[model samples]
Target: MEFRLIDRIRERTVLARGDVRLGIGDDAALLVPPAGQELAVAIDTLVEGVHFPHGTPPRDIGWKGLAVNLSDLAAMGATPAWALLALTLPRANAACVDGLADGFAQLAQEHAVALVGGDTTRGPFCLSIVVHGFVPPGQALTRAGARAGDAVFVTGTLGGAAGGLRLVQGRLPFDPADEAHRALRARLDRPTPRVRAGLALRGHASACIDVSDGLLADLGHLCAASGVGAQIDPNALPVPSALRGVFGSAAARELALSGGDDYELCFTVPPADVGAMQAALAAVDGKATRIGTIVEGQGVRALGNEPLAAARGGWDHFGL
Candidate 1:
C-alpha cells in the first residue's frame, strides 16, 4: 500500500532537470550542485490542523507545504532547484494523494524545481517538504546584517492571509464566492513567496526574513539578531484592499500589524539604497512598502514611542 501510494505521487510530479543525476526510484537520489554557488536548503512539516485548517483541499495543502519552505529559501535570496516530498496519510486515499501531488507539482513547475526523492509512511495526516536552492557565495541575506539606519520594507500587502483565515473561520462575514473572499482566501491558501523580490534584494538588502510569524514578530527577530531596534509607523503600514474590506479599518490595522501566515518578505536595506531597491522590485511587479526604520534600541515600537507588545500579535507555536 505504501509503495503504491508513493508511486501515485511519483507519477504525478516527475520532472526532468539536468542537474539531477538520479531521481525518485532508488533508495537515494543523487544531485550535483551548480559550481561556484552555495546551496540553500530548508524544510517544513504541516500537520492536519496546525499549519492548515481541517477539511482544506488536499491540493492547496500540497502546494502550501512546499510553498512555505520555498518562502524560507526566498528569505535567503535562494533560487529553488529541487524538492523532496514526504507525505503521510491516516488512510491511503489515492484521490487525495493525486490532488496533493498535482498541487505540489504545479508550484514546483513554476519555479522549475524538480522533486528528487522522499519517503512515505503510515501515520497522522501530515505533509513534509525539503527544498534545496542555490545562491551566490557571500551574497545570501540573513537576519544579522540589518544596520541601525536601514529602512525596513515588506513585500506585498500585509495581513491578507490572517484575514482570509478569519473569513474561513466565520469570524468575519462575507460571501464565499465573492471576489473579496476569494482574494483573501487565496492569500491564506496559495501564498506567493517573494522569490523574485528576494533575488532582487540580494545586492541591496542588508537583512531579510519571510513574514510567517507576523511582521512584528519576524522583524523583532531580525532586530534582535542584528542587535538593533525598529520603529514602525502605523501610517506607513500597507493593508491589502481585500483584507481591509473584510476586516474594516480598525481591525485591518491591527491585523496588518501582527497577523501571521502572509508569507511576504520583510527586509531591511540601507537608507541610501532604498530607492534603487524599490525601483528594482517594482520592475518585477513586486510592491515593496517601507513601513519602519531600524534604530539603536532593544525592540520594536510603534509611533508615539510605545512598545509593540508581543503577546497578542503573532503566531507562537506554543504560547498562551
Candidate 2:
C-alpha cells in the first residue's frame, strides 16, 4: 500500500494546543515559545547501515531519530517545542518517506512538539532531527553540577534492549510465539525515552545524562565531566523480568551494567533532595533507584571497590 506524507500525517497525527501554526504542507512552520523560557536545542543523526541495521522499519527509524534527540532535551529538563528534520534518501519513494514522516508526526504530537523546518537530500538512507525545547533559565540540568557524596540514580530497567537486539539478530533462542519475546524485541526497536522523569528531576538532580552508552561507560562520563568517581552497587542496577531468561543471572547483570541504547536517565542528586526527587518522579510512574554514589576518585568502581568490567564488549565506532 502506498502512503502519502500528508495523508499519513492527517491519519496519524494528533494535534496539541502548543503545536500551533501550519503543518507539513506549509512552506515553513511557525512556532512561538512560551513566555519566560530559554530554548534548548539538540540534534541527532541516524545513518541506516551505521546507526541501525539495514532495512530497519522506516517508521522506527523516524521515531528513534527524534526520540534520541528528545532524550538529550530531557536530560536538560527541557519541555519540547519544535523540530527540524533533514532527510537523506537513496531514492524518491513517497511511501517510504511518508512512513517515516508518519512516525515522526506521531511522536511530535504525543509530546506536544512541532516540526518547524528541515531539508530533504539524496544519499544513502539517513535521518537527522534537530529538536528544540524550552526550560526556565538557570534551571536546565547539566553534567557539571554533580559533586562528591551525591547519589547516582537511574530510571526503569536496563539490558533488555541489548538482549533484545541479540534476539532480533537470531543469536538468541527467543520464541517468536512468546509474548515476552515480542515485547523485548519491541523495546530494542523503539525505546521509551524518560522525558517526564528527566523533567521532574530538573531542580533536584545536580547532574544528569541519558544512558545512551552502557551504564558504566555513561556514568564514567558523568564522573569524568564532573571531576569525580562513582561506586555502583551491582545489585542495584534494574534488570527486567523478561531479560532474565535470555541472559541468565550473571550475564543479565553484565548486560544491565554495560548494555547501551536503553535511553533511560542516569542522574545524581544530593542526599537532602532525595525525598523531593522521589516525589517528583512518582508522577511519571518511574522509580529513581540509587545505584551508586559520587566520590573524589578518578573512575568508576564496583561494590567491592574493584574496577567495573563490562560483561559484554564496549561500544566502539570502529569494528568491535
Q: Tell me the number of clashing residue pairs for each predicted model.
A: 0, 0
lDDT of candidate 1 vs native? 0.88
Q: Which tens-of-lDDT digit does each residue in 206-313 have in candidate 1?
A: 999999988888998999999999999977889988777766888888888888988999999998998899888988788888898999977999867799775453
* Poorest stretch of ten by lDDT in candidate 2: 1-10
Ten-residue region with minimum lDDT total, candidate 1: 310-319
Model 1, TM vs. native: 0.96
CA displacement after TM-score superposition, residue 293 of candidate 2 (Å): 0.8
lDDT of 2 by residue, 97-119 (tens): 77787778777877887775666
CA shift of 47, model 2, Å: 1.3
Name the lDDT value of residue 237 in candidate 1.
87
| Regions of model 1 farther than 4 Å from truth | 311-316
Model 2: runs farther than 4 Å from truth?
A: 1-30, 311-320
Q: Rate the local accuracy (lDDT) of all candidates.
A: 0.88, 0.80
* Best candidate (score: TM-score): 1
Among these predictions, the greatest lDDT belongs to 1
